[model samples]
Target: MAKVQVTSADKTKINTYTFFLVSRMDAGKKYYVVSELEHLTLEADSSKVSRDGQFVGKLVPESGYELPQNITIEYGSDVQKVSGNLYSSVTGEINLKASWHMLIRAKGVKASDFFVADHVKYQITSSENVAVVGTDVEDNATWTVTDCIIPATVSKDGKNYQVTELGEEAFIGCKKLKSITLPAGLTTIGERCFAGCVSTLTEMHCLNPVPAAFPQLFFHDTMEELNNSSPVYDCVLYVPAGSKAQYAQAEGWKNFGGILEDGEIIEPVVGETTDSTMTITCNAFEQATGYIVKVYEDAAKTRLKDEYQFDADGKLRSSSFSFTIKGLSAGQTYYIETMAVREGYYPTPIIISQNTIEAKTTGTATANEGVTADKPIVCVQDGEVVVRSSGEISVRIYDLSGQSIVAGKVTGYGSFQLTKGMYIVVAGDESYKVVIR
Candidate 1:
């Protein structure tokens, strides 16, 4: 698809009888003709046959058909083709028919109307700009991801579109998304864009320095599922550092929890590694818009292995959801760290040599710290809070309203009874969810 700007001046300045070539090609060599513009209206002409036996209307129209040059049919028995304009030929007194394809000002189509870039759909805003329409569920690689970032520009077919706005219900029903970051250049957000991502979302990052306008029911169903006291519940909104005050007064953003600046929220754990390649994962840093991985030549972190950190575009090297460091000597012990990346936030520098956390697998009701071990200092066992240790270990349980139900210091073993419900069991600096049913 092609995006062109047209104005009153274009009516006289541009080619009038010229054929507008707006074509698209896919990997399988299937071709399509789709064109959309701001001030221009493209109407294709597909009537007569060409000189070298090629049919007219060489390209298929967005809302019409492509017909071969000549076709013989019963004159008035089964003619079903109808268009804005029709033409027929008479061959030996037998009526011959041909179909024509033309697309006028496209106000009826949406998906095939424009183009997609970087697995996100875009609606043409102008000759030079496009707005995010929605996530491409069929082509998107981040559907199960918890954190997704919408960039300022996306490239497709050797062209780039400035993403300035987000259409209504853009991310609706994206259930796996726990957080998403909007680019700084974005000026508008539509209604229910974040719907269906309810209690799972712990944070949202809006990089726009100025608050974007929205409808009154923009977060209608979304806020109803969150724990916000007013317009938002337990969801935290992270805005730019200096723009927090402006967002505090903005209608669409003011009522969320903790409108704060960016901070460190990554917990990196090393995963499958080879001589030159490795994967670094984190335990759900909800505030992270992106991630950055750096490799070091020395364990002390003095010399950086910059070759492995960025790509040709100067962007951080990353795979889908993790960092994979390549091009290393097979047996060398190089150090690496993956930090939670955002627009204006920098996490504390991590030393791979000092990292002790292992690869994590998040679950619905487990809040474990450190390596998994069977030592029952505190655990849930069949509707009872169990605590056992060689020395005295503090054990406590709380209800939903932070009401302490069990408070005790125990040695060897101790058990507290509870009915069928949910409780937060705490032991030292670690806490785990125990549900009795």
Candidate 2:
């Protein structure tokens, strides 16, 4: 057996004021010193949080070129050693050194402190990045965060940090979150950050006009409608001025149906028009609200001609309503406005200008001269004629001209291929005008 000798250096005895052995891990016998370092520990929620600083061995004063001997600690069968003096500091002290400390936080340690706003938890990192950590269950609702701590950074218990990203599942299962105003400086949103928040989340106000890089499933399992490309149903993404086009082209960001700029609410779209009727579609914030569609004869939209309201009981969030205004003059320009009404609040109204098609009556023609007026109902589906009445019925399809092209009999449901054009379909005494495209 060989005996071992141990020697230690104390900087305090030399009146060096304060000595710090910056610790670093190395594989060889060479030791290094560092000034400052950071370490993260995995939390129970699977998030990473920084740990408090630790103390390293004391630093020894520089002697001749002959390097000082290494120090080793022995405990039963385990042995550990730390190195110092990497690159010398300008002050003649070894600021960078090798550390034997495990760096990783041990179990039973409390998590880091975080700020709370509108029931949501946010942790600020040393790099000035914000990370959404968690939220309080009892205070779930549509939260609007106007601004975060001023100066972008805050100090708590002598620790300084800033906000930058979102942790995984930050808003998961927050079903009552009707909307959220994201703070600026957010660069990344972890996977599933908004998962399970689909039920009531209808609006997202992103202060960061530039689209941030989002990971897979960022909106996964949310209430929004999902398509092959993305899951952006019923929600609106509001960005800064002149940023609509940028967001519209970014992946995930483009999926939002309504990507409007701040202060720009999308007006209702006019869909499907006829000589006497026109359909107007509008989006709403929540279900159970009342919707009103008003038509005006003048461009000012002050003179109301007709008013249409959806059955209040039929209102639903994450859906659109199409209202048709009938008894209107053909080939006439009209001004339209849509309003969403709730019990306690009055939402902004949207206005648009529309025109009705010119009115025309079909010329009288006799295809089945004896056919009665009560003919089977007919419709077009997938470029084919579908007879939606019981029993076989005589079917005659004619082009825009009185010329009869196909004369046949279809029972129950039937399909037929016709050129992409307007045609008059006659079943018994009934006639239907359909377009195939």
The sequence of per-residue lDDT tens digits that candidate 2 reaches over residues 306-360 is 8876544654354555666677665556666665543321133221111221111
Which consecutive 10 residues in model 1 have the weakest lDDT in total? 87-96
Q: lDDT score of model 1?
A: 0.49
**Per-residue lDDT over 1-437 for candidate 1, one digit per residue giving the tens place of the 0 to 100 score:** 22222223342123222222344331122212222322323333334322222223321223332221122222224433212113111110111122122221212233333566555667666766777766766422246667778888876567787889886656656677777788998987766566555445657888888888855545444444434424543456777657877987887677664465543223344445554455655433333344456677666778776532322122322322445555655444555555543332113321111122222222222232222122333444555766554355678889878999988786656888898666787865567665554
Candidate 1: regions farther than 4 A off: 1-106, 110-113, 138-142, 221-230, 264-437
Candidate 2 segments whose C-alpha is farther than 4 A from its true place:
1-112, 137-161, 221-230, 266-437
RMSD of 1: 21.1
Cα misplacement distance, residue 262 of candidate 2 (Å): 0.9
Model 1: residue 11 alpha-carbon error in angstroms:
28
TM-score, per-candidate, Cα-based: 0.37, 0.37
Task: Give the whole-model CA lDDT for all candidates, comma-separated.
Answer: 0.49, 0.48
Which lDDT value does model 1 have at 66? 20
